[model samples]
Target: MKEATEGRLRLTILGGFLGSGKTTWLRHHLHERAFGRVHVIVNEAAAAPVDDALLSAADRLTLLAGACVCCTGQSDFLRVLLGLCDDRSGLADPSMRVENIVLETSGLADPAAILAMIQAHPVLVRQIVVVETIVIVDALNARTQMEQEVLCRQQIEAADRLILTKTDLAAPKDLARLGATLRAIAPGATLSAARFGSPLGLKDPWSDDEPFALPEISEHDSSPINACQLDLGDTPDWTAFTVWLSALLYARGDQIVRVKGVVVTPAGRLLLQTVRRSVQSPEILPESATPVEGDNTIAVIGRGFSQDQLAASFNHFSA
Candidate 1:
């Protein structure tokens, strides 16, 4: 927790793999006001962003959708950072200036690349001081993810602090092994556990546990993950759609890493999310909240699937 330079703003980068609970943790921290008078910038790989709707607790929020900041959206990301710096400089009252910023990066992003981008920039390097890099790890699915995705391993290696989410769902023995594995990967990172969004004390009863052997992932090992959006027209059949989604996950869960969307149902505005084959209970959004522009459209993030294929499959099942 190094202090920011006298005039520079402090920035914290929050990154994690797909379905790793980054948003959940961020939402909670924002509600708790963990970062005083902070601004939040959320990046989504999908064109239709859903996570931004859930993070309403920030004092000021910016959405950078349709690209990951590490690569395709690098220019936009830099522009936003520079704009914030300019805005702060223009403020005559030092008390009115925003000194802290939290960047919740898209799951596909690499924090290391982003840090390098900032350090290499002439203006940003002087205006912003990155205080920390916190990455969330999915306790339940990280074993499979780490073995399959090189990006996942890169995220862990770049973390200054690692927060293991879904700790309640994972067995104690498995949790110990995963903890050991993460330590092996990022020895310098401080590790802790959380359930849903609340911090939990992690007790490693199995002190003698061995780390899981992670195999080398080659360029040819898997298909690149992409975010594809599916439009559920104004009038969607909730019952039929549920069935189609369940069947899709059952058949292709391995390829479909994450699914998230907001939909207006008879019950209310429902926020839906799924990770692999596990479907979280749908949460109803506040009735007073403003409507999301992309309601009824879901973003499917994973490999081995296209938008057309998803649309056709839903149509066939619903028909």
Candidate 2:
């Protein structure tokens, strides 16, 4: 149990638009047997359970149907995660010492929303660290998808690594154009090309020392994206903040992609997160709070909201 509390669990989220080959890539990875003692969570299993079936040989894998982790299925996701914590001896699988977790989100899912939830869950923050966000882009259709689906653009924008899949099927000229477009959309992310299940010359991005880079929110109106950071200082009223957050999310669920923060409340340090309208229960921080210079800070990514709007809403939670 002590080891579970102290040990590190690295988490990697796989995201992409529909038909982007996320499952194929994951299936290949599993086949390679490179990921050791890792648990897998397949979201939106109802839409396509191929990934889940592919990993069914593993002793610790979960398939979540009828909901995406970013929204209706978040509570279930948290429960499954808590069960994976090695400290939960009663629930965790003794044969499998979980070292890493790979969450494959639905093609239509927004990775930002899932990332926010992971960052703001108390148990998760202490027991697991997100290593990277890998987004699969279909080289043949990425340009069209990016232009048509807001979720597609959001996925690309939030990725730490963008893997262009189906390259063999795409024309060389089209692939090149897609590459240029992705660079413009996700300038800070690492990009690579893959054909079939094999990543072409791409290296694994998760080493213990690798730095996690959160996605940057755009300030330009042309992008329909905005990122707001709120510094709530060292302490805040827990009840007030929760109330304000719930009301705000309820009112603007359609516009918000996600909200995640570490706040020092009067009760104790807590992790808070919301995806659209599903707000997860705040968990008490572990004995040691991850030091971040400032005690209480929150980051939000969304559309149709201005910084002023977010700040005003946050004002109600001010200590």
Candidate 3:
């Protein structure tokens, strides 16, 4: 895995409004045949359990929150990242072996702040290469929010690729209205529709003739502080689990920018992780904290997520 840092990381930063289907879209992205080994940094504003469904994928997930990457992104980003760069840390995936990274920003994150931070981070600048920026817009609110919400506009205005999600929930004409507004904001970006199975060119932001520019330096992607860890006891009725998870999310959804953790259950241990919205599939890890190279431990990074609220949902244990 250390060898991966030496070449093209092809890192893509994912941005979107809350509940715009970013995580669901990413879950679908995991099965891609062309995708090499992937690493994710989940950032949210509050503490919430990771989507247990992802536990089936091989373990390679990290959580960062209670402090956001947008604000503390420089320190948290490098610390978690260095773990992957060092094969001794045991967080990097052993298979496929290419260290392709994806950073999922909070719903309220400004792409400009995120990019400038990454571009300037001393370790990251020397270690990784950013390939593109992808922003997802909620079809239901794009128009209204773009006109009224400062943060919403910033997210759209800074994207390299603008993806409209939840189109199916709106009328054809309404969807067009949303698209028109997004075009006005991110005129230089490739605008596409995203659904399960197909990425719909979200990764391919523009043509060779088009250019991907960086967001301004004045903006910051920081959010409030928060974190979460969910304990499912000794076992779980995994099929019926999404209910409490949904409740926990709604409790602090507005405050959450990222969430990540692993759940140990009788059904064989499974890992869990989530960015404020999008999540990566969890991989299996050894049950004990022997620090073996193959062990799985989940972590998240987000903005303004209260530690007290997160504590109610989950607990911290020895690694």
Candidate 4:
């Protein structure tokens, strides 16, 4: 582990299920320029990373690829975090002090597990203080996911602020029901709604004047959820792809917790993201964004699906 820096560092975790818009919220935060010298740690399980493309230009961003931070990357998480801060040795430059650290956990991460790791680590306990655990919930799918996925419930139960993303697509009654359900699960958490990341109160953790309260670590069992990716040799026709996806979601969306990927579509480079049955409109990536070959891939993280079933679903669209 890297040596710890002398000054206090505020850390916040941006946690949510896949396709719940964690990255979108982070982009909005960066645009606000609310924090000074904020450093971001993006934990991704994909073979090809995407958030790095979205957040690379920020003050400082590091990608910890190939594992979920709450699980395989816990030690790596500490290492990268400690590395970002200058060691207390006077030899380190003064300008190297990091004011804040934001960690965006993978969609399937367990926030309690993350909290447990931090609370137990010796270096982290002394150097880093948690400001908030902001959990983004997809309004359209919250009820089903909360009821079906233990990890989703754990994340929500562990949040200091629970943000409901993509509320515009939900009907008033449905949104109301979702709110009631969330309150039932996490009555103490602060709730806010967002459409395209609006009203996102992401700020420097220390800005809050109240005494910081850490969320309780959930005691849910840590079970493995399978994440499978399929490489689409080329972008499939948008019309056909949507039709296929709609059908798939209609049939098995309950089993598929999250779907996300990049595609070089005829329209342009696009990012497709979804949680359960709520699929956001494809985001048009800037031409400067890292280019993906015709080898673009889509990842599905869920339960009850064999790898072959997942591959066949994507391959069916390919034909």
| Most accurate candidate by lDDT | 1
User: Ten consecutive residues with minimal summed lDDT in candidate 3?
Assistant: 205-214
Model 1 spans > 4 angstroms off: 1-4, 288-291
Poorest 10 consecutive residues by lDDT, candidate 1:
200-209
* lDDT agreement of model 2 with the native: 0.68
What is candidate 1's lDDT per residue for 1-319, written digit by digit as tens?
Answer: 3654777999999999998999999999999999988999999999999888888999899999999999999999999999999999999999888899999999999999999999999999999999999999999999999999999999999999999998889988899999889988998889988877889887862255799999989757888899999999887889998999999999999899999998788998899999999999999987746555889999999998789999999999888
- Backbone-clash count (model 2): 0
Task: Identify the leading candidate in terms of TM-score.
Answer: 1
Higher-ranked by TM-score: 2 or 3: 3
Q: Could you tell which candidate, 1 or 2, scores higher by lDDT?
A: 1
Give a tens-digit lDDT track for model 2, residues 109-142.
Answer: 7888887897798767887777789999877666
**53-143 per-residue lDDT for model 3 (tens digits):** 3423423667664455677555777777666656533435455465677777666567678778766877666667667778887776565
* Candidate 2 Cα errors over 4 Å, as ranges: 1-6, 45-48, 57-59, 86-95, 201-319
Q: lDDT for every model?
A: 0.91, 0.68, 0.57, 0.73
Clashing pairs in 4: none
